[model samples]
Target chain A: MGLHFTNGYVRKKRLQIILLQMQHIIALTVLFHHSYQSKGEHLRMTNHSAPTLNELVSGVVDRLKSAGPLYYLLLLITLSLVIASAVIGLLAMFRGHEHYYNVTREIPWGILISTYVFFVVTSTGLCLVSSIGHVFGVQDFMPIAKRSVFLSIATILSGFFVIAFEIKIPWRMAIYNVISPNLTSNIWWMGTLYGVYLAFMFAEYLFLLMNKHNPAVICGFSGSVAGILAHSNLGAVFGLLMGRPYWQGPYMPIYFIASAMMTGCAVIIMFHILGYKINGEKMDGDMERALEVTTKVGIMLICVILFFTTWKLIAGAAGQPNGAYPVVMSEVAGHHAFSFWFWEILLGMVGPLVLFILSKGRNLKIMLIASISMIIGIFVMRFNLVYLGQSLPVYYDLGVNEFKEMLTYSPSIYEIIIAAGGFGMTAFFFLLGEKVFDGHKVEHH
Target chain B: MNKMDFNKLQNEGVENVPMQQRRDFLKMGLAITGIFAGGTLLSAASTFNKAQAADFAKKYPYSPHYSMVMRQDRCIDCERCMEACVATNHVPNVHGAYRTTILEKDTSDAIGSTKEFIPVLCNQCNLPQCTRVCPTKATYKDKTTGIVMMDIKKCIGCLTCQEGCPYNARYFNEEKKAVDKCNFCIDTRLARGEKDTACAHACPAGVRVFGDLSRQDSEVFKTVHQIEKAVWVLRPEAGTRPNVFYTKG
Candidate 1:
């Protein structure tokens, strides 16, 4: 009887151990599922909802049941596409086959390059804005400071995503940049500086979160200085190109900084308003102060932007030794005239500037409208900066047979889908943050 | 009662303190004030010294280095440079890309004398503004070659260089995520031990010439030295001190 009892007891113990191990495994799987689903599903769902401007501005989370399954399906499709793209890229590299999308001598830059710049610029702006509260002691900006830091980090990750997709040989770029850094190269400096800046920002934020014994004042100050330098360096990347007429200018650095400030402010304001709506929290004094400060900054930035535009046009109007005035005149009056005058100037600049001025930085309704307009306007500005700058010919007087035709660029569907995927990724990360971390914590009144 | 007696005795003894003690406290106060004032003066002087040491002129220029020297008399508005650039750079043949092209302006008759060709490129200059504003040091002048070469690998593609170059020489390559312009074909020619640039070599009429100004015996050096009368660089007002010289034929 004792022998039988011992056998039974051992069997029971073994069963218990197996059950415990199974539970632990299940728990880990659940964690993984949540992480993946948060980014994958939420992103797809948000895209599919075709969330209206109102929905976006209001921060409405769509009903999950209907959108959830579709999102999963979309996620699966996106994953497949990503895999296919990777495989194709690898095949091209290994087999030495020419990919159709490969930028040739005529069009050396394309959608991938443009997208990469967009993400990097946005990330730089985000980082700078986040640093303002901690570094500059901008008391009003404190409430959103942590959130801004998180967003900046997230944006930087997004930048990496676009760049990874853009480069034919990303590994080569990474290795070459470290080993064979050309000191005179603007691109090298930009990459190196931003890389360092990202590290610093991450460290600063981590220190803030960990409640480390380091002096907060010193950390903040150093981070701010680094952020400004990084952001300005990003602008210098374009400004340093004396060869590219459109990008060569002293005002570009100033313009870049101002615009970054504007965008950063807009993003914070929009996010704050959205967070408030989602959490059903009343707008507090700190939030109000943050909005007010951002509004004033945004308005001032607009004025600066106008000054830049006016001066650029006036200079271009003046005749050049090479009689280059026609190029400028055509830009102002020719085929690209619509984008320059309307999309860039009207929608991006004038529209937002007018809104901000009329709102007087007081009314939330007006501020909301102005913020949305500014964001859209900024996108237009980026597009113009990227596309218009490239639209001009480099050498005008080659032989008749050798005369190059006008350049053309239209983002392929794959490119557009990938861009959409980026947006999805952003939305997914944001929602996950809200869900897991309770990121929408209300500031004390 | 005994404690009260002692306290009263101590209180009575307070009058026995020295008057010099009061003067000592006052002297200490004055000494501190004097030290503070002296420190302030010292700090101010040091700040001024640092400011004097800073040479703002040598640091960076706020404007383009080379300005266009328009010789209106010689302009014939052939627009050859514009066409050639489009072909070479593969500039979108669309309306926007005209780095160097002709602009039509009627002298007397709106229809007849309406065009003039003006070749525009980076006016290599003494005080290139693009180099100064580059925060990342992405844009730099070659000490040996005197050519401003942009390394795309380092470029963050901010487009500030375009605004700084007065000649509108800088073009942002949307595809490359960097600025592109007439490097005088530095990557292809000068860097590869060639004598001249694609633009200079391609110009059939000898409208453009490329040579190192560093070599005193070079043709460019002798030409600038001999024909000092009519030779002018573009936009002398920009303070760029352009290397390219233009003469109305």
Candidate 2:
């Protein structure tokens, strides 16, 4: 909340503040180690004897110091962005959202909702992908499980960060969501389940860190189940709406689950490789094999999505249906044509598929490129999905002047900044996690 | 009129033509059962049923069952009703944020009016999606009158209710920091013993007739039950089972 300093002041004091923070962390770690060690407090004792709290803290500080200048620069940039966004979000709350946000009465949702969806989708995908290897005992998937689980937590937290600003009365939501719950509302289900899923994931991560394999596996399984349910309910939030025909029916829930898996595969492959790069470690045979299988899964899911898209387009376009026809036409040959073809279809799906095939799941570089492309494409895909559904006015069929044409909306500066902050939060947490967790190394059971 | 040349008849668009007028045209010795192929072809097999008692409610569930019936052809876009609603409801002066508004349709080729104006408002449906889909019970239907009411304190302003509403009636009130919609003046005048809503009271052309539909003698119930004119609700396909009805005299 103290992100209100002037730009010049921030520029001058940034280095000094970072250094001071580091010294404080080191001092705190030393004090903790002395106090605990003097008492001979054994928090948990395992056969491997996982690193103690003090050791983890000291090690993280050392890693932060030893990390390349690029890492520090990236961390600094992301942290500043997060601070700036926090300032803007707080401003929107007091100053009224109309001045800062572009959302109108006609179009109440905008980029923030889409970004939230994108983050949660990535989170769910990560959970599912990691569960296959760790919880289900798949040997190939085992290597990437720890890192994916950590990233899943990071991504979902980012999602919560973005949506908290979007919901106008967030404090009320937090209170009423527990005390006065609505059983019929999909949003209530999604929010509650995601909360449960986050708890399970945190417990699982702690268990994994403590080298308590059985507890970790149980938590991982529960997290995955909760993740799938929460993710599908999010889909149903849009899908079950009878008014928005473009998103109506059983299609969304099914598409969401499949798409989350696909996204999971892409994110897992990308982050695992990036994790090694940050740690300056070479990919072991096991990790490489894990990525290969992940790639194979990605390819299969891509095909599945293509099949789904083809039919979705046909269902919308064929015979020029009542509610869906105009929306589909707009996407195909109207305002959203370029976004659909280039981003959602080409970069999101086709480009990644081609690159992954070329990599043969062996070339981490090509795989990384493919994953990056897919990530950008998926972000756009999510934006399009949220925006396009609201494009057609509810009274478009009546042929009135106001409701006859498609409504257009674009994110304002504040919205874009807040959205970027969600990204920054994920990146910041990720960089911090890698160093703190020692690249999330998995000790084979 | 046997084996009539259908192509010779001028195609009057259905937008301005009431169902009763079309039914009358069918009764001109044509005995048409239904319009098919997107209203291009007429088929006759005696599918016409005068009474819609089954489709219409036989028993009213709510005691007061507050409802409105619009005489569609009578609306002349005076916009007096809108002004009255704004004044009565404390509606903010902003674009696309209104408790009630009029929609104008260009019916250039109709047999009657070249253009038509229809008043629109929250239907206060029997099965309101806004209340059903609300994450909290911020918006709900009144048990006594079936008027959809809002608890401003409970509203989180997620705007999911706005998205869920098929009628485009709900809007977020910036001042209240909550989603607001028409509650049939329940808080304003109805609780003060006013019989009619502000819009209905202000209309000069007798377009809006507001009454409790539970009583058979009430204007709304009489209008809705009469077979002499076809009464309908907008977007019937949405299946909200609305409390509001529209008819043309």
Candidate 3:
């Protein structure tokens, strides 16, 4: 009887291991698919010559059908996982289980939440950049302004998609926030301000599409002001968290704004370059000038970011009575040392800065490389800001505190898949925009 | 042309009537009836029975929704509340998930003394900022219960609400494109008419008290009256008029 029981347990364990291996394989496949298939140029090129809508749809279907039983098996697995996640999410909401969350008392916030902030901040930045040309009449940026508006909307929608998966009671959030308002809270103001900004932008874009000049101009200006306030308030959300030493400080809001601008410029440059290449169009003088201006702005922002980072580190190293400074310093220096020195500072900040400077603000090839570098750098900066902030141990003065060791987090395969899905959605939107809007071309009045 | 015609008309002559005669004629015979009718209506409605005031109180009471009033002095900063909140809410492991938490404040002393603990949670303010800035009306306060809630379906995942919150209370669900924060466990407990949150139930020190202030006889009301001087709220200057009250002694 004992031997039989042991054999059964072994069989179960083996099954579990097999399942884990399969999940890993599937995740890797998804990542590969996104990296190649979802890329803007690749997607367009592959589908460009496909004669008809029916042919394209049939081709996609045929490809899936021809992939044999293994492909079908993978499809089944993917569908099951999606269904299971939805059911589990529903159950969690209704049943209210404490064990459902990865968050603990020691680390209150986690990776998913931080990434949400990263996307939204970037989106808001994109909106602001687009507005500079459309509303403020910065003629230099005019060539890319309309496309920028489309990108801003797309990015913001993508940010919203991330948050939808993260929150538990989204319906409740929608209902209470408007029906019951608190005027004094920065969050309230930020939400309302952005809400207003979004409406204004939507109106402005609609007007642009309809060839109505006056309303677009009026709404664009109003939206820009509102966007600035909303973006600054977002920074205040972290800055006001005095308890979290890493987040607290007057510079966080400014840092967020500057970073937003940098990311916006990088995105616009990337899309424009890629779009032009795919269309087989030569780069005009106006487009080249636009690139130059954005690159200069990006380079200057990088310098400002470096200054803020340096001051922050220096302040932490020079410890005070709170012990928060030392704790933050050591976490950056000792535990997250590699991420801080290599990824965050070197690759993310200095590398991009030097690349842009060396490019001399001209040369398409060099500028493209610099822009890509800056984009990667900004992502790394976001990762470090979030992950490193939560790495330190939270200690209590009492005897033998339970949470003595540093908290650790590595993104789960499922989490990574979901993140990749966000990129997929972005590409999908961009493609749809390209197909429908004739690439957002504006006629000169 | 209009100015010239007006000058000719004005020059033709206008006579002023006696002020008292004009006033008397205007009054006519309705003065006594008007006074009597106004006095009767005023007498019929007591201060509490005033229609507009009662309607306002019913619609937008004194407290907002999904807010938790904390007593800082009573808090030991055990963080039981934060743990309970995450477990019950299934909040993703991300920043800004704590619906209710304890904040520890201490000076940087080599000897590690002078530590202070404060419990922080959603203030459930009369003027909730989270609700005001929601673009899709995803974040809102409940009409009946005063609980701030989120609608996931409508949320476009703009982090504007996250940025707007001064208390660092709001979080973005990166995967779903929605905003999240402490809802005071209203959906799980309070929606079903439970008395307190998981944190309040889990707290061993009896420092956290939960009650409806709308009911004058509730413990929250008594505490507010008894320890008026010791109570405080986080960033009261923010003008949120938070429902979450704290007491420090």
Interface RMSD of each: 9.0, 0.9, 8.4
Q: Please give, for residues A1-445, the per-residue lDDT of candidate 1 as tens digits.
A: 5334357779788789888686555333222111112322332222123433333222322323224454446556655554555554455444432233443333445555555565566666666775666567677766776567666666666666655655444565666667666665555566677777677666765555433325544555565566567667667666655445665567677777777776777766666676555434477777787778777777787777788878777777776523235446655887668767776677767877787778776677777776776766676567566655555444332211222334456665555545545544554555444433334332232
For model 3 the local lDDT of residue A235 reads: 73
Q: Rank the candidates by DockQ, best first.
A: 2, 3, 1
TM-score of chain A of each: 0.74, 0.90, 0.75
In model 1 chain B, where is the ten-residue run with the lowest total lDDT?
Answer: B59-68
Task: Grade the docking of candidate 2.
Answer: medium
- In candidate 2, stretches whose alpha carbon ends up further than 4 angstroms from where it belongs are A1-54, B1-59
* Model 1 stretches astray by more than 4 angstroms: A1-107, A211-220, A276-285, A320-327, A357-370, A397-406, A440-445, B1-249
Point to the candidate with the largest lDDT: 2
lDDT of 3 by residue, B1-249 (tens): 698787776553324777776667656545455445533442212322344345545524745323344555466777777787788887777544556556666545412235666676666666766666565567787776677778766564445455445455666564544566777788878768777888887787776788776665677655554422344555554556666766543
A1-445 per-residue lDDT for model 2 (tens digits):
5766678868569868887688666544333121111122323334554445556465556767778899999999999888888889989987788889998877888999999999999999999988998899989999988789989999999999999889888988988888878999999999999999999998888777666689999999999999999999999999998888899989998999899999999999988888899978898899999999999999999999989989999999999877889999999999999999999999999999999999999999999999999999999999999998899888888787668889999999999999999999999988987876667877755
Off by over 4 Å in 3: A1-101, A321-323, A391-400, B1-249
In the range B6-119, model 2's lDDT, one tens digit per residue, is 757888778899989876785643422222231222111111123344533433578899999999889999999999999999998877679899999886755444788889
Write down the DockQ of candidate 3. 0.03
Q: What is the lDDT of residue B13 in candidate 1?
A: 63
User: DockQ of each model against the real complex?
Assistant: 0.03, 0.60, 0.03
Q: CA lDDT of A48 in candidate 2?
A: 50
Q: Write the per-residue lDDT of candidate 1 for residues B1-249, one digit (tens) a residue.
A: 798787776444646668887667767786567445643432222332343336323422322221223343464545555565566556555323444544343334322334445565766666777776544555777765556767667654434455456565665555555566665555655557766655555555666655654344566544444422245554554566566665444
Query: What proportion of the real contacts between chains A and B does each prediction keep?
Result: 0.03, 0.66, 0.03
CA lDDT of A225 in candidate 1? 65
